[model samples]
Target: MSKRSSISRLPDEVRQHIEQRIAEGQMTLDELIHDLRERFPEHADDLPSRSAVHRYGQKLDRRLAAIRASTEAAKIIREHAGDREDARSEALTAMIQSELFESIMELQEASDEEMPAEKRVGLLSKAAKNIATLTRSSVTLKKYQEEAAAKARAELLAEQEERLEELRGEDGMSEQLEDRIRNVLLGKA
Candidate 1:
């Protein structure tokens, strides 16, 4: 087994406080050692070495980076999901408007006594064609949005899976337990 770190000898609370400060970029090793010496003179000899503290800081930075990437992936998934819903709603509205326009064209043709029969028919046909084109465009937009959302979700899952694999390789833990830990760390659990 590997030797235990000297920093591990410190109380959990103290260790966490030191790590938190390091992670927040609030203190460098020299600064931390000086502050510790000043604040807790009694434990001056027990303070961690500069290299140990630096290693801990680097580890914390990696964890923070992983967490941020996971959060950004989730945000992308949510945005794409919202876009898909918006596309579907727009398509539905377009279809409804097309039907309404067609109905209005028929009513206008029947009610306008001054308009010639051939001219009225031509105008009605043109309006109907325009509405059909809009409806088709909406349908196409909805399909594209659906595809984008699916792609986003798939990419996010793949990225999380890769990160989990890397964590597993580094940790050498049981797959099931590592998965649980990964979920908890990523806030999925």
Candidate 2:
């Protein structure tokens, strides 16, 4: 394929430069927006059109660049900072762990706090206890409820089957009746 056949392609050097800017956090959404405005100076004349296309496109480009940069940075960090004890790495690790610990403690404290009076009373009252007792009464009660419902469904199904059987029997019964009626009204042949 001819090199010119490739559509809207950036040179490798330009692509690398952009990727580097992203990794260094220099190519942010805000920076992209500012750069776009500076480059496309006429875009601000019509607010609506600019807002729809120019602004949104700039924002999207910035977000994509930031994501690329972050991925590249993570790769670089993993490769260069492997098992190293740099001050920055230690600080980041300590900060993350402390934050996690604090969050866990806060959650535990929330769970241990006395519940609201209304909720506590609802769960622990004599009436609530009685209801709980009734609900928990023999496993057979629960089983029986399910069984009774199933039995009712089976009874309805059996009734339908019986009705279908009666209808089928009537087909023969009808033929017998017709023969008897013909014999009575117009004598036997």
Candidate 3:
């Protein structure tokens, strides 16, 4: 009944192109279909209806929203990437701590003086395994935290160093004079 319904169907390529233009926010669905009818009158009937185009547009809208959310998530990831990894490692280590390891540590404390040599040796070996697990996990967590902290500090220092260089360049300080001022500045101000 509509002007578009009078002619033969349009090709998938043109329909897709129409959708692309709509997704680009370059035109409304009605305008797109109307223009398609005008541009390719022979395929008017095949061209998508306004409602169909609108449904496709809704899909595009949802896709755009998802893209926006992921972009925001990526920014958050970049802002806390190092700290997040360290926190994860620490959390996992804390969660994995076993009763066995705790008992081992307690045994070592208890055996400091009076435990017999034979019993002490057996208990110590078992305790050593448990303690090693704890120690290794603790050391790993510590190293991760340390490495993350060092990386953050290095990045901060690099940025400060870049800013300092920019300042020096802006003021046209000579190479030797820059070093002299840098020595007096004491690391990063």
Q: Which residue pairs in model 2 clash with each other?
A: none
Q: Given candidate 1, what's the lDDT at residue 121? A: 75
Give the range of the ten consecutive residues with the poorest summed lDDT in model 2.
Answer: 1-10
Instruction: Report the poorest 10 consecutive residues by lDDT, candidate 1.
Output: 83-92
Q: After superposing candidate 1 on the true structure, give the runs of residues whose Cα lies further than 4 Å from its correct spot.
A: 82-189
How many residue pairs in model 3 have overlapping backbones? 3
Residues 1-189 of candidate 3: C-alpha lDDT, one tens digit per residue:
122321124476676677568768987667787788887788765666777777767866887886687567656666877444555545445544654556556655664355656775797787678677778888977887788788877887677678668878755878877676566554533
* Candidate 2 lDDT, 26-102, residue by residue in tens: 66555644554565455434222223333444555686876677567666767886523232343444444554456
User: Which order, best to worst by lDDT?
Assistant: 1, 3, 2
What value does the lDDT take at residue 106 in candidate 1?
A: 57
- Mind giving the per-residue lDDT tens digits that candidate 1 earns over 1-189? 133576778878667778768877977789987776787677778888888888877877887896687567556656776544454456456556866676665547564455667776787687778778777877777787788779877888788878777777854879788779778756799
How should the candidates be ordered by TM-score, best one leading? Answer: 1, 3, 2
Candidate 1: give its CA RMSD in angstroms: 30.2
| lDDT of the candidates, in the order given | 0.72, 0.49, 0.66
Cα distance off (Å), candidate 2, residue 10: 92
Q: By TM-score, is 1 or 3 better?
A: 1
TM-score of 3: 0.36
